[model samples]
Target: MASVSALAQVDATPRVSAAVTMEQARMVDIRSLVPDISQSIAYAGSNNFVGAPIRGYQAPRCWLKHEAAEALARVDAALRERHMRLRVFDCYRPVRAVAHFVRWANDRADQRSKATHYPDLDKSKLLGDYIAPVSGHSRGATVDLTVLRCDAHDVDCEPLDMGTGFDFFGIRAHTDSPEVNAAQRANRHLLRDAMEAQGFRNYAMEWWHYTLRLEPTPDTLYDIPVTAPTDSGRQAEIERLMQPYDGDVPGVSLLVLKDGKVVLSRSYGRSDLERGIEASPATGYRLASVTKQFTAAAILLLAQDGKLAIDDPVKRWLPSLPKVADGITLRNLLDHTSGMLDYEDLMAAPYEGQIRDAGVLALLEKEDRLYFPPGSSFRYSNSGYALLALVAERASGKSFPEYLRTRIFQPLGMRDTLAYVAGGPEVPHRAWGYSKACDGWTRTDQNAYSAVLGDGGIYSNIADMARWAAALDDDRLLGKASRALAFERQAQVSSTPEATWYGFGWRLADGLQWHSGESVGFRNTIVRWPKQRLTVVVLSNRNDPTPYDLAISIGRWFMADAQAEPH
Candidate 1:
């Protein structure tokens, strides 16, 4: 079945004497430590010199030896302090992938990428110097990346002008090339300085290449597929910690995930006290303020589709708003720095009925002034998100709920998750909220703002939320660049008891990304430790005890071994 060219290609590939197992290599994904670092893996796709997807790259993930990954995380952390980040192009090359590169280098017939990659050099000259038979990446202590600078608000980010593009096989790609101008050379040195401070030595020929000073496995190559790691133990301890929810009254649903696998999923108590239905992982509970994250995501999706820009002024879309809202931008709304007056504060005493998102917009349209000027300070405003829902509807020309269903939930295979619009579509496996009374728990679910679809009105269960958490890990629904904007610290919440920062819709505290929701009778929270690829979600129907602190305690059990400090 093989042709002469194919047989020759196979013969040119070198044999691998030995390769280490994953456990022996002790490798970790850089994303597990630096969650917000940007990645654009060139070889994993058809964007590189070979002009084809390389073999042995199952996923576009960056894995390095434990020590080297830690060092790279340090470099990323130091750069973030100055509103900068690392955008990696390649890491931890597999032996087979290297073989693919070598085979392509020897084939003189395939000159498709010549103009872009190796314009000045002959293909025959690439084997010894650039395309080596054995690469340091196979040993798992090497990485290729460039620096990116964010705007003053840390919202928009773009890569710096390096002298030459990555993988360019020419003298201009050299780290100390004299052909580069002053600004480009300065940018190159800036990256080198940051990486060298963390014990990385740059290759003199390539500006984007660097390796750890001390390699963990200098001789052996690692061939384990790049995938998320899953631990076998730690299930019983988690169940014991969640024992309180295993009861008869209105209760909670909990899900714990490690490396994208379900570690513990259990629900206790009754979802419907009247019907005598037991709670399970499928019981849908109102997300309350947690819905803000979905609303923010919807806006970002619209931006990605070229419907709107995150930096556009609110008045550009909702022109009927009063002059006080003129300076507010969509970024301010997502960051909760818009300073829009809380619509709840503007509601009449003992409001007659539940105010929908449009009503919230109407109330803001009449307000004369804001609590503060836009982007001047931080104040969580439900009004901001409600207005964003209207913007999403107008931009996409579809109802907010419909956009989420077709674009996000359906694509992610989250069948039961939905935005709760009364009398539109009934919730499946629904759980009614309850509050404690002197005698027993009382039904106290919907309130004046329950109908609002943006600030706090989405329903999901443990299973669906787990899918959402996994989607955030990669660019399945959101691109890598958009994720960086949403995860970056756009606002400083407080510096008191402990430092806390606010990204788009998530809270950053003590190296944990989390958010809590509270309504009339629902209290829920989700905590994520990106460094360990761990997540803990607590969705409760009774409001007596808040689950924010509880979720953090559960997250700590897994992140106890993580060494990277919080950004």
Candidate 2:
């Protein structure tokens, strides 16, 4: 059951107060202390019962009173010792956001989120039990979270089944509901025990909701906008860093993520210069080699399903390959140690049609020898990924693109991402690629190899890419063992300028995992510091200077002590 104050806040006659000043309150970003604590701020996005971003939630960052934040961090640390984690859905709600919830609850016509959030109860009936006029979250000591079970290495993690999803407006959502199964009840008890040990009390009516036993400011509500840490000055400095893309020409979309939430998302210049459309977060750009990560993930997923294995020889999947590829394994292809010849070099002069994945396989099938014995040395090979895509199709009994859609993209909520193929599916919110000509930028979106599905044909936007990154960080798609295997160092890429290794599709160097993608008219880079739980993505449509170095610079700004690493 909800506390007396919690019920009182759910008054029949709702009221909205003027925004309060936040200058006197000492607020802290929870991630500043608990960097690994996962977040999926429901009110900050359209996934909540409101069906839109609640007012005053500028970003998905979590904030809490200083004492509360420290206590929550302790809880997280204790969970980590047990190979588990705390994933917060809401923390320190704004008074305005609570008002937004109140207004939405009062409106009888809006039932858009009813089927999913409040299936059994009428929308009007939710006001007393769920849609409260005032929320303890505004006091900055309250939180909504669930437990995530993890592997021994704390890599792959998934939320425990607590009978109902976050914000579910039904009795099943009750922490001790008899309607829930035994496992669900035990999971709820597990969460309650951990939280209570840290001086927090759970609201019985909502399994996810919690408040500090000794709240620092129980009566005072905050209206301060929830934003990334030190957002003002840092945002300005980042804007200056991105000045090159701030004009009416082919530009870039930059997304910075920290603690599983967006820290920054901004786009500059025009996605379609001829159409006079400015680039926005939603503008999809060809990911080029960055698509390799997704390709690698698809194979790993198939392996999880018992369709294939990383150590399995390439010949096992694509028997059409000549004897030269007999020594190559899927792991070799992933780590760039296949010694496979580059497909581009094999294409005869003035190749006529766009080459697809199957065509790449055909070209390689005719080759007599690899550059070196498989697994002997590192050599970047686009042909390897192309064959891997075909292998995925053959093993899964589905088209490569179809496997990516149903198995990877759609499952991860990467709705805007796709393995682009001609006449397959039109990319929504497309950003045509560009080349810097003498007079102006010219559209050079596609070339002979544009249709290649595996190596670099997927198109995605920053928003979707963020979702993909989140999946990689959590056990949304791949399990802990699979994720660890994918990121583990397999082959040494370089030993000169700095120690760098290749893992599946990612480059590992000095505690950082990164990769760059370049094609005819797109240059992109995604740099991630897994330990720090930060990721920087830069996507450009114009072919000129590569964005890898720029992406590193942006990442360095966020990292307190960045180590020297390869681009």
Candidate 3:
């Protein structure tokens, strides 16, 4: 449900013939405010999600800026002499949404759809073809598009079909696909020509993608939290009924909910621990492996679509899957019982394709051994979760980011949450992760750099995390049975066999649903006790903030308070 592309203009008459200054629209894009003039035009374009160019569309849904609309009006007027008008495919987008596209194209679950969209394409051949982690759209001025008829009275103007559907990844997404008729290709060229005339650059692989030379906003990208529309009651009572994280001291944010109401929240310590910027509920942290729950949610959504079954063997799609490290089920994969080795161990530092999840299988597929029989015992292997990440990719016909965004992140309105990659522009109100030593604090890697896409790579704030906990408690994110199964503790064999417990990336301590993640320079924890409406989360950038001890004490505090509260 995010926009397919970015940088759109409205061919419209400007009221007072005035243009809105970029100074006026400092944060939100100007394209979001006013209408365009050439309303009858439409376009054909391809999306990375489906990996092919799709034809037949309508006018833009989001509006254009007053100046851009006026500029478009001028262009339309000039083109009017030749019976031409601008057509569009997509517009201003959230950069995180582009990450969504990468996730979808990598998914193998819906081969049927791929076959229909790009008949000559291979689902396994996506990375080199359509998907790449970095995106031009993220720059805020690019778009994917094609032209349409402007002559409303000219004998029922026909819509041209592109060679393949939007989101197709093969040669079909190319502008020169033989499958499309010459006229259809000509129309595409016409739109491209118009945009190029306006100084917008087109992407070579995807002819629809274009970036404006003079962008409305150059460097500011807002990390707006996805929020539910607040009713008057909730809005009015929020300040009064809500709790505030008053501890702004140790760079930690805490929120406690009881009987469906927020009871307490405290934040302490500096967010910019060096600059002495105090932490607040808005201080964002890399969710780290807290992302897997959303990845698991994507797989379940695929199950809901009947695209794949949770209990299916991983080898069903990845036929070259190594022999059962144990008698592993997708269930076990979800629960991390598959004895797959942890991929994080293989990389010294993850960045620039160093530790991609897909590469893990290729690495393991060649080995003649299993860490253990798949079901023989359990190990807290990121490798197991990494492979299940592949299952999610294959099953959703989307990248891990897209699957989570569309099915999980967007649905819960965790607006500020993002399965974000690094190297993109820095976001606002975002807390940079830190690694503190005698050398002082240095920015730790972003979640995406860990190459732990499904197992980690999500960045969010305490507020968004709170919403995630609430969503899980409501069971709106997953079915009751799935939720019950996901939270059920797993009995594992380790050095000490009797006390080991884990559950689908969720660990259990005293019947609490919990999980902890660690990597270079950071540690994170989240614990939820649904029966008591209890949730705890601690995200620290330093290699060790003693999170386990802090979580234990916090959990004890909540439990003690529960015992004392009168029913």
Candidate maximizing TM-score: 2
lDDT scores in order: 0.80, 0.82, 0.55
**Pairing residues by index, what is the TM-score of model 2?**
0.59
Q: Indicate whether candidate 1 or candidate 2 has the larger TM-score.
A: 2
Q: For residues 310-332, what per-residue lDDT tens digits would candidate 3 score against the true structure?
A: 77877886777666543567776
How close to the true structure is residue 512 of candidate 3, measured as C-alpha lDDT? 63
lDDT of model 2 at position 420: 88
lDDT for model 2, on a 0 to 1 scale? 0.82
Query: Which window of ten consecutive residues has the lowest lDDT sum in model 3?
Result: 240-249
Report the lDDT tens digits of candidate 1 across residue range 321-404: 899888999999999999998999889989998999999988888887988999999998888899999999999999999998
Candidate 1 lDDT trough over 10 residues, lowest sum: 1-10
Query: Top model by lDDT, which number?
Result: 2
Candidate 2 local lDDT, 241-292, one digit each (tens): 7756754468788999988999888777667767445566887899999999
Clash totals in order:
0, 0, 46
Model 2 per-residue lDDT at 412:
79
Candidate 1: pairs in clash:
none
lDDT, candidate 1, equals 0.80
Model 2, runs deviating above 4 Å? 1-232, 561-567
Off by over 4 Å in 3: 1-250, 273-277, 323-327, 348-353, 423-428, 446-449, 493-498
